[model samples]
Target: MSDHQKTEGDQSATQDSMRPESPEAAAHPRRLKSFVIRSGRKTAGQQAAYDTLWPKLGLDPGTPLRDSRSPGRESAPLVIEVGFGMGQSLAEMALAAPETDFVGIEVHPPGVGSLCLQIQTSEIGNIRIYQHDAVEVFEGCVDDASVDRIQVYFPDPWHKKRHHKRRLIQPEFTAMLAAKLKPGGLLHLATDWEHYAHHMYDVLAAEPTLENLAEDKFVERPEWRPETKFERRGQKLGHGVYDLLFRKR
Candidate 1:
């Protein structure tokens, strides 16, 4: 069956079920969440990739990621990306940085399937995926001080005033993420929403363990990050993009 067909089938089974508890929530018992489940369709090719490739590339949230090596050599730097939509940029980065091991955490199934297809078609070996809440992945699976870099690009802005509580770059979340980073590890964030950018700056600045790398409040977009489709749409709408780089102290 096609990905969309599978999703449609799965939705019927899950639609009446209560939302699954996040690992973080189970650990700490919190109601706040940065993302909501959305229904999305996937192609037949993507579904095929999920059925064939997910077993090899998927990581269970209950299992901790140990041993950074992928079969042959010494451990390489580990980069974890949160909420990689459709896995385009994550795959691009994995292709560009062969020496770096990449782990992506995303809740959406179609995105995971799309990424699996990319890994299969491109023969990319350095990237693995966790189809779970990023908070849960960080709190449960990721080791403390094990990551070299963390990337959060264009996270849901949660634009309404009341919805601001759902923004991902809050002080508490920043501190939690900081704890998982090795000293001197980098946290890179990019957003087209100016208000969210400022919020990120303030929250990150309050964390004693993190230091902003920008000379000013925001830094220029680094060359390594490819322009995503959402970014292009934002550009067309005259929204400014902000990049923030922070190093763990």
Candidate 2:
């Protein structure tokens, strides 16, 4: 193989070696995003899911929503749910708040499939999907100040001290996301990991343009975000849940 290809292969090997050897990792994290596919290639399952659900969700090709406005002369506020695993909360929010349009970004296939199935079964509209890295999608696809709210529930904590760099709730990423939100737009983040919860608080507090909505450091989990199976599993093991809500300055 060429030098570039050889380097890529070596990096893949390193990642495979680093993944946890526990059975839980195998049963759940089938393959890391970096190893499974490039940024945008949908697997057969994802493709089938989209094909089945996109129509029901009203996200057909040529859908006028790419620019963050509703069809016709009226414009609707936009909400984005990043790392929306299986999209349960997203669907609930969409059904509850039909006036707002929702865009969900996720990299996992089964999660996307599950969300699509739900959308089709529910016959819901007013949602879109971008099956890619949320950072790139936020910067490239979404317009400045176009979003009214951003929801990120239970993102991968990257719990290891050394792997902390890979955590999604970083200052740079949040800054980019804040720029996409309108002034006073809300950013909602939740986590079940104690260490990562404090990490999120520290990072968001340091960002100059965002302010915590809660009077205290932490906010109670709202009724809206129903606990998922993964979260329930964590809770059964005594993992505490934390939530942080902030508004753009």
lDDT of 2 by residue, 1-249 (tens): 111122334454468568756887646743222112323345576568778766554332233346434566146878888877667878888888877788887656665676787676677677777666676676667778878898888776655565565567888888888888899998889887789889999998898999998888779886766666766777899988889999999
TM-score of predicted model 2?
Answer: 0.76
**Highest TM-score scorer:** 1
Clashes (backbone N, CA, C under 3 Å), per candidate, total: 0, 0
Model 2 residue 80 lDDT score: 84
Candidate 1 lDDT trough over 10 residues, lowest sum:
1-10
Error of 1 at 68 (Å): 7.5
Error of 1 at 50 (Å): 1.0
lDDT of 2 at 155: 71
* Candidate 2: 10-residue stretch with minimal lDDT: 31-40
Model 1 lDDT on a 0 to 1 scale: 0.80
Best by lDDT: 1
Model 1, residue 172: what's the lDDT?
Answer: 74
